[model samples]
Target chain A: MHKNIESQLLKLIPPQSKVLDLGSGNGEFLEKLSKKNISCHGIEIDTKKIIISLAKGVSVTQKDIDKGLKEFCGLGFDFVVMANSIQCLRRPLEALNNIFEIANECAVTIPNFGYWKIRLKLLNGKMPVSSSLPAKWYETKNIHLCTIKDFEDLCADNNITIKKRVYLDADLNPLKSWFTLNSNFFASEAIYHLEKK
Target chain B: MKIQQNSFEYKESFHLLNGGSIPGFELVYETYGELNPNKNNAVLVCHAFSGSHRAAGVDKETDKPGWWNEFIGPNKAIDTNKYFVVSPNNLGSCYGSTGPATLNPATKKPFGKDFPLLDVYDWVASQNLLRKSLDIQSWEMVLGGSLGGMQALEWSISFPENIKKAGIIAATSLISSQNIALNQVARDIIRKDINFEDGDYLIANKKPRDGLRVARMLGHITYLSESNFKNRFGRKLQDINNKIDSSINFEVENYLRYQGEKFSEYFDANSYILLTKIMDSFNPAGRYNDNLVDALRHCKAKLLILSFDDDWLFPTEYSKELHFAAIMAGINSSFIELSGNNGHDSFLYANEEYVSAISNFLNHA
Candidate 1:
């Protein structure tokens, strides 16, 4: 399953291209790319995690994404990733726009809030709580949870074209059916591959 | 355990260069690791402001461990078993080296406030003299943090052909405005103290302890993060029974006061004044008129810049700026923003990830 996801992520990324991982926790993905001889770097907020990434011998910077991406200007990476961290951003759309200018291709992952379990909770006049969002509403760092459809609309509004979509099962397996219907009821997460139009 | 101390005189004083009358001096320092016949295993450990040649092991006078005890030794990051590390006390510091605190030959009195405002370049020049005196031409790696990192950067640039690798942690290409302002406040506190006596307190045989303590307290605040402070002290009271006393109230307040009191014990007020002033003036990027990117382009060592996430004093943003500058300058650079809550002081503490990151970088670089 890991190998399959790796392959899919690899297929989307250009070979040996410079990659920047935003909110890169311990640089797990960057380490994978480094093994493939890719020039990978990252920006993380947690100091301890940055140390872990450094110990792994990955190049990363500890930075707050809310500030801006001024540090990355002119040194364009081919790919920029916002893996599992977009929702935690203070300004998700603004950060996405900054990422768009910093990299040629962007890969973003957001929990599918439209999933049946979440929809049912909302229908019952209750805030949604699922395994993906384990924290209490007040305690959660996820300030902007966007559904797959909502994200698609956002991309369209921002003039970003979707290159591919990968819907994951509860265990992060890629679903074989239409993500809108199948993922809404079954899948746990979704990743969107996007590029500027 | 062979130890030798030597000093050299320079005809043209750096003080003269900075419009002072004191003469330039040099300090040669060394250490023992496993020595190969070729001496290729030697590592140069540079000292930060107020630090001495005593980078590792025990100091005879204090009977205490070295300043970088946490990260140096047999199996530490800059392991003494694998690498021979030599850290020299910078020329203008009040350690074993000659500085404002050193006695002048002509006047038979300490340079005191008469010492010149020394720059980072001057410190590197003194190291060069030490290197020549020791007959050591090149170092495998130059390692340091803070002012030490600034010296490492200067070493890498000034003697690009002499160093193989450089590690700069919790430091900046230029001292930030905020840090300068903080130092200025500390200086002002000391200057305002009646005991300061306009830096001419040598005859009085008394030091400005109260002012120095306050200065140390203010400076200490910047070294720690809010999260760290909250976790360690929060709103916790110092003593349960003394709630109504309204003195030495919170644990955090007591901690800061204790830190200030202890710091003033061994450190001199004048030395603190000079060092803090030097730190304020430190700008490895050089004068404002010059482009910083062009100045950084001179670095030849494979670079590793480390910053802590909670280090608001020199935040991760600053390290990112350095990484970008180094990349723009076409230097083989690596940057890491470590997850730490200890703020700027994180580099001196034990965070497993930080150790690993540095070890891995050193092993690979």
Candidate 2:
């Protein structure tokens, strides 16, 4: 699930960039970035996740995402990335604002709740269940789930410029050709590289 | 394994930060592993407020290991096998060192309240003198937590050319007002005792046991958080048949009482007051025009700062400030807040992650 997203993130990050990752689970991504000579740190809430991250020699601060990155001052990092965890935040917009304040650039991935399968499920009078979001409604951690369009709108409203965007299917394969194109509602997931406008 | 305690007497008399002077003094310390020929592998580990110079190994009298035995063995985090380790009890501590409890040579009486006031700066200077006496020119690193951590920081600043790295765990550049207030109340408890006799209780051969117990009781409370206290004791009664109106009803009360009693047996009341006052006045930036970032700019050692999530006394926010200041000073630094529910004392516990981080940082040196 992370291999392709990591490649996309690698493309966006410059060499030797200092990075702060939000919700960096297990720290495998940061470890990979460190191999590329990038200084990496993380913020995670779960104790087990933090232990796993620390075991990999990644410095992670244990703090709730809802509390925001009040510890870090403005422009502390070269890049800030929150992969596959933005939807779980109680305040995604505020988190994004904090991310921008701490770093010059950021990347965020969102599971497209507006995918065609979800639309089909809604038409059939049922909630969607896809590989990217498999949990039942009540048990899901995606408290603030949003579509690609909704995320783009949030970025525009918050004066964040979208530098790059990519659409992927359920298996994380890029939607490069014709089977269905030109609409975010048809993709399973979306990744956006953002910067302050 | 057995560890031998050693002492060094500074017969020349020393000066203190508060302009007080001592005619002569002694420092008790311990060493582990062999000092390499080049003398570059020496690492000094400072102790917290209540800690001693015995960083590792078992004591003959108590049949117990040192406070940081897990972190400083042959193959442990600090790795004595690879680095020479030196730990010294601070000047104002009651542990085997010259302090208020020690007799004054001139008057032939205990110094007690007459013991000169010392701060982090004096402690750093004294440690530096110990370093020189041992024929060591510079250290590979200086590591500590809590009050000890403050001294390590001051070491880097006070002796900028002597240390290469510093591992500061659960520490802050300055003590918060809330923490100072807590220390104040502990002092009040100690002073209000009728037996205190203006810090000269030893003359009458009477000890202020009750007052010292109350002070230690509250001081222990500040070391932990409500979350940790509740999670550990959780309204559990000490005795099932005991009434709630009793002096000690809950398990936590029993725990605190036991700890306080044990503390009063080993620690001197005057030493506690002096140490807490030093802690209360700790500010590494005091000499740098009160600008923390500017003060940090003078530090030549690389820094590794760690904090625990549940540490309310020196919370993660304080570590963040230290990190920010280090970054601003353009020093190499890393800050990590560990996940633990044990509050400020989490630094005392040995965890795989915490150990690895320290090992990794020291290895990089």
Reference interface contacts recovered per candidate: 0.55, 0.16
lDDT of 2 by residue, B1-365 (tens): 32457898899879988797988789999988878899888999999988999889877798888888889987899888788899999888988788999999989999999998898999999999999998999988899999988988898888989998888999988999999999999998999989999899999898988788889999899888889999889999898564333676788888898788888888899999999999988988888888988898899887778899899999988988887787667565667788777788888888988887788778762
lDDT at A58, model 1: 70
Q: Which ten residues in a row have the lowest lDDT in candidate 1 chain B?
A: B13-22
Top of the candidates by DockQ? 1
In order, the B-chain TM-scores come to 0.90, 0.96
lDDT of each: 0.76, 0.84
Each candidate's interface RMSD: 3.1, 4.3
Worst ten in a row by lDDT for model 2 chain B = B240-249
Best by TM-score: 2
> lDDT per residue, candidate 1, B1-365, as tens digits?
33334455565655422445456575746474654577766677787765777767777797977777777777777777776677788776766677766777788887777777777777777777666665676777787877788777778777787787788888887787888889889988988878878877665667787898889899889888999999998899788663423677798888888888887776767788788777777666664355666766777777788878788887766766777887777565777766787878877775677676666666653
Over the true interface, candidate 1 deviates by an RMSD, in Å, of: 3.1
What local lDDT does model 1 show for residue A191?
81
Query: Model 2 — TM-score against the truth?
Result: 0.79
